[model samples]
Target: MPAFAQDSDSETSNNTMKNTEYVTFYPSYGYQDEGLWRIPLRVWVHKHGGWGGKQLSKVAKRVVRNKAGLEELHQDQIEMFRFRFRDFVADSQSFEAIFLRFDQDPDEEVFRLQSADGDKRTNFNGLLFGELTLTFERAEELLTAQQSKNGWLRFTATGKDHQGEGAVRLIKPQGDSVISDIDDTVKITEITEGEAVVMMNTFFKPFQAVPQMKALYQTFDENVALHYVSGGPWQMYRPLADFLFKTAGFPPGSMHMKNVRLHLLEGETYGDFYRLIKLGSVASEQQKIRQISEIFSHFPQRGFTLIGDSGEHDPEVFAHIRNQFPEQVNAIIIRDVVNDATKNPERLQGMKVIQADSAFIDADG
Candidate 1:
């Protein structure tokens, strides 16, 4: 059994515990205990590396069945910790200590912890290699300590090969589904001629969704899964993720984009094949439709709605979906762009196509 240790110095002791241990804790404001709010303390452990250089013990900790389930972590009432490793130490260090405080109101169940309480302290004797002594008042006192007691202590540490650390917080949205677009959808004002090519080179400027679109997004974020499928390069994934969460208020979800390179070369180069198949511009869109179909097929209980502007091939792609899976598609809302909306009259005859403003009004109603 590995041992844990806590900081010994009184000055550092009052501060957050930054030491080599099995578990560390951090204070979370949103999560509460017995009326006291607390933070999550990520924990790390050492394990054997398995096949393909994968760490086997870390994998075991993430396994659902054993003792690693997210629910199990909450149920076991285990203190949360953050894991870290150091090149010199050759062991992991867990920082912070978190506990749950319960609320008296049965109807309003709440949990909290006093992370800043000066009274809280831990000790490292070196004998208990990976053991820790975390002392705190009962759950009810957590909030009181937060107000009257010393502020919570937080610590940072360096690590070599820290494992079994960090807790997973499950974020459950209330809305049913999230619908979005690609190209100029979250990127800058591109996806169209004239200004499209110019906007491509100008980076750093944030690519945000229109305000009205965000307002619409607030309507169905809780239950539905959000998806962003674009005809852009897969390299845009990270930047797009940041833009969506930071600027556009779009939650992370399944994102499909062009393969760029397929299993087998269709021509001299992948770009050649992409242009030959007219896929360079709409590859992600096709992949997105297939993904939507797959998701709807598996989850029949949830209804899906598609949203996009008619600037690009959205009309053609969405039309294909309506023809193929009319039953699965509850509604198709397309924002009119130029005269494309009028041109697709044949496709919009049966499906639902409305201007952006009109859709917002209907959503508000």
Candidate 2:
């Protein structure tokens, strides 16, 4: 997910509509075997009742920078962040209704769901998001056989108020999956750059990727499954997925991104173990450790090669998985984001995880 907010499936068109509505299937990945496979689908609703331009306050006009302004790049990034914040403040809302439709057929023919959980649906801005657990049995086998650019099948989610689509990528029982981070690994998110990271995300600017990382990914792209795991919010799922294909030239696979949840977001700040918690809500900011562990657990027979960066807790998280399921994880590649990458060259030398700087990617990775 570049810009990390760039979502190919999450957002609606840029609009000044008085009332905006949208739906999305976060993660864009699911799993099925020989039985009834249930995929969790979340539907986000945005209802706004004012001009889009009115969403931003007067202060933002002075804050958001012009293209040729001083410290242009940095200012643009800050402006992007402010733009997102303004959107969050203005259009972001919690809502629900009885007629939340999830179907794969364009004409509502092959697959459809009329009602979900008795229809007493509702949503909240932060904690109470709406969700539906889609179930399937023998039909799953038929779906597994179907093919498209992204995954096994494409699903359409339509509410009386809004409609959207997402790819339901499946996890196979007997195959290889390469699960890796997007930011700072495959793409140049510049996480360490702090506030300056937003510029690459705004206004259709071309986002960059890590050198040779694409080639490294392409090496396995032919005969393996690619799962993108990232810290980017699911709100940007659409453009993010789009960029992965057209810009990065990576094969289509399932996406696992952040869900904006207060506890999970604040846990890191409060030094709490919220990242370890993994139940209850259908949509919430799932900590990477718990989410990645779930993926490993989902396909015990499948071997996974974890790739992430030293920019955050990816090294620690991937290392933990490697230690726990050393056999399932084929390799752990950690790309250095900090300057002093060689401070402890001897550390983790005996393990399968390889920590190399960006310069050595194509040559070593």
Candidate 3:
């Protein structure tokens, strides 16, 4: 959609190059409409270093050979092209610049500069990386290419020190709706409480839902936008984003959470303060409820569903949303936590409250 420069010419010239080449790969068609195909391409840049320094000598591309290959691409593939960098010496300063051009179109060119570690361990930048450009073509060509010889598409790119080539495919979008929690939703393992203090520091994987959630996530990802609201601090946005994209099966979308600095307090300790100030005061949960209300208020035509666990205030918060925004909320599903569904009779009355094991099935129904 937009143009990106991979590296600066100065940076490229500074590095010593034992070899420099460009490789192109086949293109992957992601989405097709009105004869236009959204193609995905993966390009890799490799470099070798000299006494002066390490430098990129070649760039390579990976193409999808089958539909199953599409799974290798991450969510960012929907909008951006990404690659992983591997094999570098420890503390060595070596980088590679990649320039991508599609079909001799100057305006479609994209660029990126990737650095490598000196160790052989192969470190990746972000789990996702890449650039996207629009291409105009008939969908028939894409479908035919898949079935015909040489019909499959490919990607070609030139690099300062290297080149790459590969195949491409048309990918279909996942249309699913996601209902998620915010606090332990994507960050620390547990909710923000006294126990969470130890849990957070225990080096446990972030609080992302287990892989079992993927089935439920896929159910709505193909059709509905993910709605993530949390009682946790909003500062965890970046980690949350990574968690959703990498661990949990949430597509890119907006996240809602409390302003901890403005709402949550210190001196009382995280746990005591949260329970005393957060649940004790309706302001925190109210903030989330109001956000949901605003969402339904603006998009009344779209179906809205509520997903939360009984661990914290999700039950009450979701119930409030259901009561206030009945027409917009298709269903409310709460994952049981404390086994005290009756604690909040007002929140449970007439609403669907299922155990975690059953919530997904009931939500699908």
- Find the candidate with the highest lDDT and give its number: 2
Largest TM-score belongs to which candidate? 2
Tens-digit lDDT string for candidate 3 (20-84): 53232212224444444433333333332333222221111122111113324345432122111
Candidate 2 local Cα displacement, residue 240, angstroms? 2.3
Better of 1 and 3 by lDDT: 3
Rank by TM-score, highest first. Answer: 2, 3, 1
TM-score of each: 0.45, 0.69, 0.46
Candidate 3 ranges beyond 4 A from true positions = 1-179, 184-188, 196-208, 262-281, 342-346, 357-365
Q: lDDT per model, in order?
A: 0.39, 0.52, 0.42
Per-residue alpha-carbon lDDT of model 2 for 20-107, expressed as tens digits? 3544444445556446454544444454334553434333333333321334445555544444433333354454552332333333
Give each prediction's root-mean-square deviation over alpha carbons: 17.6, 6.8, 14.9
For candidate 3, the lDDT comes to 0.42
Residue 124 CA error for candidate 2 (Å)? 1.1
Candidate 1 vs candidate 3: which has greater TM-score? 3
